[model samples]
Target: MSNKAGSFLRNLGQFSPLDPRSRTLRLYPLKFSRPKISHSNWNLRNLLLNDFDNGIRTSIRYLFQDPFILKSGDGSLQRKGISIATFLRVDRHHCPRRLSFDSKHSLVSAPPFDDGLKKVNVNPEVSGGAGLSKEINPPPISYRKLSQECNSLSDVLDIFSNAPTFPSSTYFSAMWTIAKRMSEDQKRFEKQLMFGHPAFSQLCDQMMKETRIMYYDHLLFSLYAMVKLGVPQNTLVVQTSLRMVQERINECDERCLSVLSILLKEMDKCKNVDVLKAGLRILVHQQVWKIESIFTLQTVMKCIGKDTSIALKKKLEMKALKELDRFSLLNSQHMFEALAAMNHRSVALLNECSKKVIDNIHGCPFKILVSILRSCRELQYYNLDLCKGIADYVATTFDIWNLKQILLFLISFENLRFRPTDLMDLLMKKVVEKPESLNMRNIIFILYVYSSLNHTDKCQHKEFLEVMSSALTGCLHHISSENLLKAMYSFCIMNYFPLAPLNQLLQKEIINKLLTSGDTEKNVSRLHILDVCLKLDKVAYQHAIDLQLPLPPPSLSLSHSKVAQVLSSLLGGEEYFARNVQLPNNYHIDFEIRMDANRSQAFLFSEADVTSTNLRRVAVLCVPRSLYCLDLSHPRGFLAMKMRHLDVMGFHVILVKNWLMEKLKMEDASMFLKTKIYSVEAHPTTDVNLHNTY
Candidate 1:
């Protein structure tokens, strides 16, 4: 039956394949030149090909791997050996050299590098060797074997360019396998090879021209490989396959539909595929838990946006929520990172993610930890346990932390409105120790932490500011307008006026951008603070962009009301204080009272419709607890500057803290007010001579 090449082809129908419907054919023994042996001792029974990815999906593994031998009567092919089903490996451009593995037949043209392939002994008991069959079957190339043998990009390209069939997913597999074994430099070249080289173009061209794909899986198999490699969705091969799938949309199941959506998103063509996305989300929701790759789920999450219907987004989120347990620690970090990057917030999901991060804190990578913190901050999540764990890990391991990492950690904690005390201390120490590592942006954050988080100032802070000031001044020209204002004003908050950096910021273009660019209202508030600081510090630089901040009409805060009550008891009536008085410069005062600098007597600025020229004026700026640094009586940069300006304007600035007034008993409150008001006379509001106690 194996004697003639034509006979072998003819007899293939006679042997019943294990799968009655198996389409895979065996072509291993087309070595059918009749060797004139009416063969004595050789029995060619039980010879077969091996199975592949599916049941009875056999193919050839020899020539590139171990070749199984089958023998009977006198010898043995490993009895349990599995042989792959071999077929013709066709290249329309070049004919492949042929090989035969029939009993007593040796390889025709094996490479010299191989020690040798085992020679088959079909008839050990038979005295003489069989003559070679001239009709050897062409060998099928194994992608796995090609990947194993190649050691360089050039070799891969050579294999690709010479004697190859294009539009094969197996080729994608081969490329990646080679890429994995390549050095980092070669791996980078692998990407450039696909992007800039002609070999890739030919492959894509063949994909476009090839009309032989019989199954959707073949096309999607290529898509899967591309996604894993981060291949650009704009690549010709990917675009062609996308069109193919869109054309075959009705035939595609959910899995293929989701894959198409992901590729379209990568192409930034989600709008073009909006209809597909609607259905895609539905299919993914139906099968969310079935998915095991969190990365796949993350990519799926990124695909939905404002264009997607809210109902569909909710469904997808809910399904993913139920299946979040499917994620590992690292994967959970990635999942929430995508959620945060997309600016999609889910309370339950983030809560779950916070727990995941904290639970896995000991093993977390710094990068993943940063991502987790971003999710929390961006989504306004507040998990104290997670915050503490992250802070502890970071503080203990901060030798490895870079400037960017420290900045992100600060921003996250600052946003969460939770002070990571140890982390903050460590950062302060780092700044004092290595001020050179800081840039303009980091200097702003450092100033902010000192200005906002530090209650009682440390000597290191002054040293930090001294070192930071020079670095900040050097880079002032390169900073953005918003950043310029923030850096200067943050220093103002810390009570160190950088006259040089401030002068640099007062340019016409910078001031214009500060007043006109993004978030102008917030920008102007910063400008107002800087203006107050500059004037109070008596540093002259003339780029005053006039701004009138709207003032609230006469009203009293609860703290002001509490202060009003205390003042009325001391000065004989509620009429002794006027509330919500706007200063000539338009800064609002919480209350105004007329008292001698001694505070032995107090009266209203306009009691009984008469001005009090005899009494020194007091501007009581009632501030919320948020206006102060956490757990401290220290006011933040803006509030501090406003007070200095008021002091310059001839009103002794008396801080009326809402936190203090709101809690004080009447007896103690009156005394507190008296002490606060009278202390202004003992030690006046020091503007020019004030040192930064931050």
Candidate 2:
């Protein structure tokens, strides 16, 4: 070795074991400010002091300086570095460990050195640094060498094939990976890789190729992948996969089975009914074992009767009856299959099934049945025989949810094209027949439809409102707290639809319902009521704004006409709707209806009241002390909504209501006389007043 290198090695032997941290502390500032004491100079001093033991340092320097390394033919520095790294096996920390070699392996000789040169002595310093080591133990070895290595992919495959199954995690991961990989392959490759593989088939021999769990897991993966790949929803492979999964139900977990059940039902929700029908056919054949654990069979029975009763009483015009009959035939067979699937060999056992099974049968059968009902022309004709057939079927059955379904179908006939008179005729009959027997949900649904269509005609059967109200009150008692809230909210919203005219007794009943319902958690009930109040207030305010009526000031009174005070005691009124009101901003409302330009300085009624200008877009600004001036320039009406809610910021229903009331006052004779407004025709702008006309 050269003298410089030899000396460096000797110094390293003496200094390498000293703590690096201590060396760094002692050497840093002196090395930093003094050029002579820098790294190269430091190395030179060590080389001069210990010239005999630095073979590795000298060799690395030579490697970097070599002509081939400096000017590589391929010009790849990273390749060279990687080759060095592989050769060295240095960890990322740059600390080197023992090389893989055996004592018997032949060693290549080092390049010949000049005759005068002498090898550095490293043994003495190494022995000295170790204090009194008798001998160093051999370096640690890798554990992987203990196993026999497979030389080829064929051998690896054979190992798996001979085994009873791949490990569970490995098998599942393989299926997941293969399914994903299949999508990107050419069509031919996919067929060969997936369909031709015996491991993917359903029979026991194919299943024995892997565990049953693995096979089923792969089946799920395949089906899910098909959806993600945008295969035609009705493709044979997709359908086959679905059927295969359903066939393997006993092997699937309860949650998975539940999901499948839900999907089978929701298939109907797809726009293509044919897909739904096909899916239902496949699912109905499966024995959903978990059904007994999750559903209450008696509940379903109660619902079926209720729905049938509703469908029977629903008055259908000939046209609607015809439409209903048309819509039914296309769907009946599938509906019947779904309903029958819910029934098992034992009646007593039917009382409980997974909700998944019950709900599917409950909600879907009606849709299918509705389709069938539409196809029966005699029924569509609204013949007395058909109506009697429907009513008797409903009153006798026990399936309330199904009954709800049938009622909804009849209510469907309330569409504008169906004659309202015919619907009313059938509805009156039903209302009189089973007032007490109907469940609350069904009753509320009927009321919802009735209220929606009531309009001016509500005056004729005003007493029906009392019955409907009583029916809802009775229904509420039997339902869960969540349903009670939903039902009550639905009833209140339906009330807003111009049903029977508002009356004192009906108002009192509404208040009573609200109070009775509030007996649970006051805050919970209050929040629920507040939510309704905000919606109502928004609807009222929007209506007024759309009509351009002066709005009543935002206050507790308009929103909670029956229970604003009660709500405040629980929810702190304004704080509630101000933040949580669900009204859309773009909704149109009547905010500036009654302004008489001739009498008040606030608005100019003549040229400004053009049809093209939507005046409600204006923002109302409160100056100070109840002085409010609306900015007429803002875009009028509800702002378009980002989310669903009934309340809007900076707007309230009471103000809009008050504005409408004030607008009506302009029509009063006493106001005109007291204002001394005479010869209105003589006055162009001031003569026409809001309260003066409807």
Candidate 3:
């Protein structure tokens, strides 16, 4: 053992130093020395063996310097000992000038480049391999072709699994291609990519780092994919995708703009105001004329509300309206809704849109037309040509409209004061055809329009009133107090009441509720009930005397007193006249009289009687010729529709020109009142009895 140990120590090129204190032999320290190998003559095994002898202290640089050893296609150096097998394989086969290592075989082989693949030379600087002069570059494969070649989802996952090794653009391109092909099967694709496989999540993480350089389409595809995958909007993935869209919006084409619009709408659905604002800013700055861009601006305006600056809203509104001609019917309709929501009103823009609506009225759907009409009414922008066109369309297409739509159309027309009588008649016919569908509010609106347009005496007015009355009686319990009052008011204005049974039902069921309920905050008030009762009661004197309702004091002003004195003498004795009777709603009737049971009268003695009923036969409003000649359309005109609320409630409304009353003698005044009120054509009788008051 001692000799063997000594010999091994000697072979290790170590010398023993004598110990002075101890006479015994001590172990010497071993020294290691590498054997020099000739690079020109030695085989790879020898070099490897030499490296092994030195405990494998060889540097990668030294291995790369070997001439026989070729760099692998991936730029990695071949294993030192393995190069011998690669060289032998190449030498024996007499392979082509360029060789590639078979990764599976662990040996060199001839190039297996396919003829279909076109070789591309990648710049070394781009590849970050300054030493590499040339290499077998990968073919520029398109996403479409890649998707075609990938037979299964695993194949797609394989590409994503190796995403870190590939360039970001190449990886994103592959992903985009796969996503496009799988778009038709979005639910399946989403399941597999988002949940079924881990590679997709890993790839997402890697791609996020390179989002700044991602192409617009690639970003859009990623966003769409994530959205389809049901990713939460608050997630980093969705936020990154939105950021990428906003960044590239300016350079994007129309298709990209559309994608951005869809993205904004989705964000709006998510209530992501910040992201929506960012995208809208980019769209507005780009001034892209595409319809999608316009819609995006509109959506942002709607979603952000007052958070969106007024200046910004106006800018976007102007920008969107400039392209109104390019908008389709559906687009125009959506634009109108958006504008209405934003409360953006431009007369010129409204005119342009109105023209478009008129041109395409026939093609427009019922709901869309209703929306347009409502928008116009909300904006208070009434275009006569547009309204007439809508009316014509409604007249022809009334059958297709639902009950709600018919009511909306009619109410819009009434608001604009653009009465289309034919269309209105058609609407009335439709309502009568399906009276069961009419709710209390709809009834009120219909009656209101009829009264406003003065169509109470039209041919079908009585039949229409009967249908609405029946409908109202059936649903009296369900009617709200406000709607009930409005319906009664409408009935008064039209001067066409229901028959006895229906009238009693309305008075008992609807009017009783209005009188008792305490919801006076809304439009309906207590005074409306008084007017309704006055219109409903055939004999005004019996109603007042029985109900114990006090009459309003007559106006004692000079003009009113003069007219009242003449009216009193003509009708009967002064005791029959009551001055300025105040109703529950603060309305005052001027000089109401107790006439014969068949003809009850409430009189507005002069143009100054602002609260008198307009029902021609039930009430008389005497106005001077100057006042009568004024434009009735003016809000404050003496003959304006607003002068009376009781006209539509079966009241006989009369507007008497009293220009000659001031100059006439008492007998002349009596004759004038007789001819106007009683329709008396014969000479007056000598008897001054009150029996001739009728």
Candidate 4:
């Protein structure tokens, strides 16, 4: 070994195990060459001192550079090569523990690093002693990870509370994700947080600002959240947001249209008509000619009331018509309702809609079909081919519709004057199947339609009658007074007499209700009661069966002296005509005249008894002033409607105006009646009979 290396190894022998500082130093055996005989002349004391000084310098540098070491100023230590006793004294004050290394694994483990910095005081008189106060400051937490891993609303809220500022888009995305995964209880909790908390208002403000750049799905989610949060459509924030969307409608595609449609629908529910109109104006300006756009337009127009200007309504109608070819059944139904509400009719549009409805009848739902049918009825635009197709579809799929739908369908059929026996049979079969579902409305509608179509004979199905009678009896108290009168009127028209039990129930419930009521101004109700009593009396008298009900009072008669005088002057004399004459169908008229005045009795003919050859009778209707002024289009104007019944029953009708009788001299009145009734060319045989009567 070289002399310097041998001297360095010999200095390690001075340290003894019993010394307290000796345990801090760890030594390893070194293998050295014994002969560096050429360099063996070096001084052992000088080399040993130099080697010890180098070792001390290296230890001091390592200790200063260690990350775990605390430095007071400039990171400098005094007396670099201090004595071993001084080093041991300094280590006891600063370094509490020593580090150790494993030779086999080559790993080093140090004492735990103290990140808590202790404060030291320099003044000794003011402070009792040097105080060590440690302050802890942990690293900041990652909010991004918290947002992703959060499972409950509370966790998310806690994260939001801790975060000073977060990306609004990212926060909303996380919220929606959490909402979608939440259970019912969790959803309720979230609703509380979103609706009741102030943070949501800030979030909404952020959303409004960021909506322009936000993704379409994100925007939709934000809108849905706002709706579920019960944000009023008329609120400034909601209005501003909707207006912003409206301003950008030109860039919108079908997805935007869908969202806008939903928004307008909600606004409509809130009755925000001004906003709806504004949105509609924007939509129209964009000219987004799509079926969905048309539907939106129709919905808005309906809510805007029928007072919309003609020009704008016409423009919208033209737009809707232009897109009719692509409309679904629902679209067509909406368009029809809108047009009908606005009192606008486009025959071409209606025809196209009906064609589409017929094409899609099988896939169309019952509600849509009913709406279409009702529109057709209201507009009086009946397409025979369409009605036939609908009737066929309904007949084949009878069981799929509810009782109300089927009843409406039947009314539609009667209105269109289109009736199929099979469809009627199918309806009867349904009534028999679920009789319990039938209510008073259903029974009343069935009777009205059958009577209107002159098909009341078909209602005599034993099972159907039984079920319907029972349903009517059960719902007797629930039926309104107006509807009960209508039902009685319909029964009188159809000549349908229910079995004894239903007859007794109708007598006690409907008749007694009408008679005992103290409401004196119910003129219409009293008239209906009188008509029902007259028809029932005729029925019982003709059938020779007693219903045990008293006849109506004579004061209830509809005949007026003014009407009788007008008719008598027009019909030549009172002897030539019969007053209050009853027809074969139990419908009474003011006057009926025989072909020959010598014939004492006026002819009473059934529907089957009437023929063009045997139409030898002439009926005179002395309309009251009130009845004469009623609009023929109204269903309650029976005077105008009775003319049609008279024509169908093979009688040539003469309408004597009672107003003329009251206002004019008898000569002018007779002259006016002759011009209105007897001026027309008549059948030769009927002409002779009429000439003889006059």
Question: Which candidate comes out best when scored by lDDT?
Answer: 1
1-694 per-residue lDDT for model 4 (tens digits) = 9654454444343222112233222212211111112334443344323432333322211121111122234634332232221111111111111211111111111223533222211221222223323323222233345456987545654555454122244455566566667787878777676655545544544444444333343454455545544565444345434444433344445555455555554553432335444555545444534435566667655644455567666777778767766677777666777677666777888788777777877877777677777777787776777788888998888777766777778877666656555787777777788787777777888866655554423454666656766776677667666565566555555444444433443554555555556452452443443344444444553332222334433322466576567657655566655677776544567766654222222343333133345335778776553443122122222453466567666567876655555777666555554544443342222334433322
Is 2 or 3 the stronger prediction by TM-score?
3
Please write out the lDDT profile of model 1 over residues 1-694, one tens digit for every residue.
3334433343243222111232222222111121122333322221211111111122334221221122344533333334343422222112112222221222223333443333332222232233312433233355688778877545655666563442355566667677777688868877776655556544544443331232455566665566555565444345445544444444444455456556656554532244445545555655555555556667777776545556656765776787787768766777676776556778788778778777778767777777777777777666777788888888888878777877778776666555776777777677677777877767777777656554223756677678778888878668777777777777766667666877767767777876677888777677766666655666555345454443324334444566777777877887777877766655788778777657656665565333445567877777776666443444654576677778787788877667666776898777666666664445454332222221
lDDT of 2 by residue, 1-694 (tens): 8666555555333221111222211111111011221233433235324422332223322121111122233633321221121011111111111111111111111113322212222322242223222322222211122112333222223333443222222322333334443445543354344433443322212221122223344455434544443433443334434444543434444334334444344332322333333332223223222123222211222122222332221211121223333333322233223233332122112122211222334333445434333433212222233333343444344335444555655564432112234445445555655677677666656654554443224544555555666665554445554444444444444343222222211244443554456554442433343343334444432221111112222422123222223222322332221222223322323222212323222233333443433332122111121111121111111111210122233322222223333333333423332223223443456545532441
List TM-score per model, in order.
0.60, 0.25, 0.48, 0.50
lDDT of 3 at 48: 27
lDDT (Cα atoms) of all candidates against the true structure: 0.58, 0.32, 0.51, 0.51
Q: Using lDDT as the measure, what is the rank order of every candidate, best first?
A: 1, 4, 3, 2
Decoy 4 TM-score against native? 0.50
Native-to-model Cα distance after best TM-score fit, residue 545 in candidate 2, in Å: 25
Where's the lowest-lDDT run of ten residues in candidate 4?
86-95
Clash number by candidate, in order:
9, 92, 29, 3
Using lDDT as the measure, name the better of candidate 1 and candidate 2: 1
Ordered by TM-score, highest first, the candidates read 1, 4, 3, 2
Alpha-carbon RMSD, candidate 1:
15.8
